[model samples]
Target: MNFKEHIRVIEDFPQQGIRFKDITTLLKNGQMYKAAIDELREKVKHLEIDLIAGPEARGFVVGAPLAYALDVGFIPIRKSGKLPGETIEADYNLEYGKDKLAMHKDAILPGQKVLIADDLLATGGTIQTSIDLIKQLGGEVIGSAFMIELMSLNGRDKLPSELEIITLMQY
Candidate 1:
């Protein structure tokens, strides 16, 4: 579906020398949104995914639907203090600074296979922290998924070698 075309590019957004790939435009178009998710679903269908863990905000948008399509449970990896229960947290570096991500302590069970999802993979910090949280709780991260990847940033290099990374579009 050429999902990249649906993404809006904004220059120097939230900082200088940075190009932001906005997904709002893609989400506005119902058909394209569904098609994009369907494509992601197809890629992960063969994996024995026990749960889908999506980082806060945009990740929830695609992750929720993907979990439903795959008939697996969805776990929210939120910003610190966002989740109400006892949680496990991981600190990571951001483009500008450091941030922390939290997930419910009971979100993942031991030996369960998890797939991490997000709208984009830029620096790989957020997703990497997500993988750490899952591991701390004894869940194994089988793979990671993204709608868009800034290949120039080389985010994939930071991820573990055992994990499979799937991205629908690359920029």
Candidate 2:
């Protein structure tokens, strides 16, 4: 569906030499957004997924709808302190510093199969932290999905070698 064409690239966004791939342009278009969800759904439907997990913000944008399409629960992986109740967290080392992400302790039952989703795979820090949190809670990460991936970063190398990845577009 040429999902990449719908992505907005802002050069030097958020910082110098950083090209941000914005999905808002694609989200605003109902057809492409639906197609993206449908495609993601198709990619993971064959798997035995008990829940769809995603990081905060952008992940919510793509993960929630896909969760609905799959008829599975959506588990939000949020920044530290964003979630109430007992939670588990993993800290990731960012380019400048460290960032922490958390998810509810009971969000996943032991042995539940989870599929992580996100808007893009950049450095893989966010999702890798998310995967750690999920595994810490005993949820097996069946696979990971993304709307777009920045290949130059080699983010996949940071992820678990056995984990499957699905991305609609790469930049």
Best by lDDT: 1
Q: What does candidate 1 score on TM?
A: 0.98
Q: Give the per-residue Cα lDDT of candidate 2 at 165.
A: 94
Q: Residue by residue across 1-171, what tens digits does model 1's lDDT show?
A: 789889999999878988889999999999999999999999999899999999999999989999999999999999999999999898998765798999999998899999999999988899899999999999999999999998988889999988899999999
What C-alpha lDDT do the candidate models reach, one value each?
0.93, 0.91
Error of 2 at 17 (Å): 0.6
Model 1: how far is 150 from its true place, Å?
0.6
Clashes of each: 0, 0
Task: Give candidate 1 misplaced runs (Cα > 4 Å).
Answer: none
lDDT of 2 at 42: 98
lDDT of 2 at 101: 92
Model 2 stretches astray by more than 4 angstroms:
95-97
lDDT of 2 by residue, 110-146 (tens): 9999999999898889888898899999999999999
Write down the TM-score of every candidate: 0.98, 0.96
Candidate 1: residue 82 Cα off by (Å)? 0.9
